[model samples]
Target: MKTLWIKLLLWGYAVFSMAPLLVMLLSSFRPTADIFDDPLGLPTGPDLGNYAKAWTEASFSTYVVNSLIVVVSAVLLGAAVSLLAAYPLGRRRFAGRGLFAAYFISGMTLPAHLGVLPLFYLLESLGLIDSLLGLILVYAAGSIPFNVFVLTAFFRQLPYELDEAASLDGAGPLATFWHVMLPLVRPAIATVIVFQFVPLWNDFFYPLVLMRDESKLTLPVGLTHFFGEFQNDWGTLFAGLVMTTIPLVVLFVLATRQIVAGLTAGMNR
Candidate 1:
């Protein structure tokens, strides 16, 4: 009875969470007057005009390109740094290992919002403000803490015997890490990639504060511009939201199995 009750509760929560998404999707095809008349009502039929209008008016093309650049660059840079840094501590262990790990992990406790002024001043001095490269650096630096923490723990699980064999065959540290240890933590890498990419893709805080150019705006910021310009255009607004949301859903679906494995398997080790 208790198990069944728990299952029922979970299902109910799932429905509650999905309700808004369902409404938003329906509203995307609806007319502005219809949305106000009955916001919950279903649209008359499938209408793609909202997407076209939103795309043309919102400069979604530029936003997509900018988002892709930042997200891809950040993910690659963050993952590489995290993997290299974590491998030494997790696999090889040295003096001050614990201190180094704690130092990296400490970044998690320091919220980015608190250092906005200092970061802005520093970036301004370097002339990196309002540039996509600057945004990528910020995103990569922000991701280090969590990725290092998780990947470090995950790397600790990889068998020591593998390392022994690699070393015995005259493998150098870099080659061993590249050819051996890295592949073993693919799930963790995927998990961190998905986690970091989702937030960065939807991120508005850093973009709003750091960037001034409309041409360099990401999807989330672009949606803000769309909303500000089309305050009463519910259909187009929802369409823009739908566009922003689809990528997240697709990413989650693609990486769901790896994410589950990483979350479940890492901590226990």
Candidate 2:
């Protein structure tokens, strides 16, 4: 009876969570009048026309490309920087290493609003305002602390003998990191990528704050163009939302198992 109840609870929660997504998916196929007439009704069929209308009318082609560029560049460069920074703390017992680790971890706790003023001023001075490269740098900064923490914790679980073996093979610290430690931390890397990429791809805050140009806007902010103060295009808007959600849905569907394993792999260590 208890096992049955647990399964029932899981299934119940799953339906509750999925109901909104199902509604949105069904509504994306609907004409605007159908949505107003029967908002919760099953879609008559897949309306491929809505997607084309949203993509071409809303300039999503440009927004999608912009989001992809920012997400890829920030994640790759941020991963490289975080890995290098994690090495000393993961493998060594140098002075103040605990304090140093704490410092990096503290970045996670710091309120984003506090730094916004200084960051904006600095970027302004550097003439990076309204620039995608500027947004990439900001996203990378936000990602590093958690990424470093995860990578370092994962690295610490490795056998110290690996470091010794590499040292024995004429590997210096950089060579050791590049050839030995990094290759072993692949799961953690994937975990970080999945976690970090999702938010950066969907980020609206920094892009809204730093960018004033429409051509430079990422998808999250760009989606606002479909709304007006008095009226909203319900059909096109839903279509746009469905399009925005597809990449993330596909990403998780493909990698959900890997993400779960990577996240839980070092818990026992």
Please provide, for model 2 over 154-186, each residue's C-alpha lDDT reduced to its tens digit, 9 standing for 90 to 100: 889999999999999999988999899887888
Cα error, residue 87 of model 2, in Å, equals 1.7
> How much is 175 displaced in model 2, in angstroms?
3.6
Segments in model 2 whose C-alpha atoms lie over 4 Å from true places: 229-232
Worst 10 residues of 2 by lDDT: 225-234
Q: How does candidate 1 score on lDDT? A: 0.90
RMSD of 1: 1.8
Candidate 1 Cα outliers beyond 4 Å, as residue runs: 266-269
Q: What is the C-alpha lDDT of each candidate?
A: 0.90, 0.86
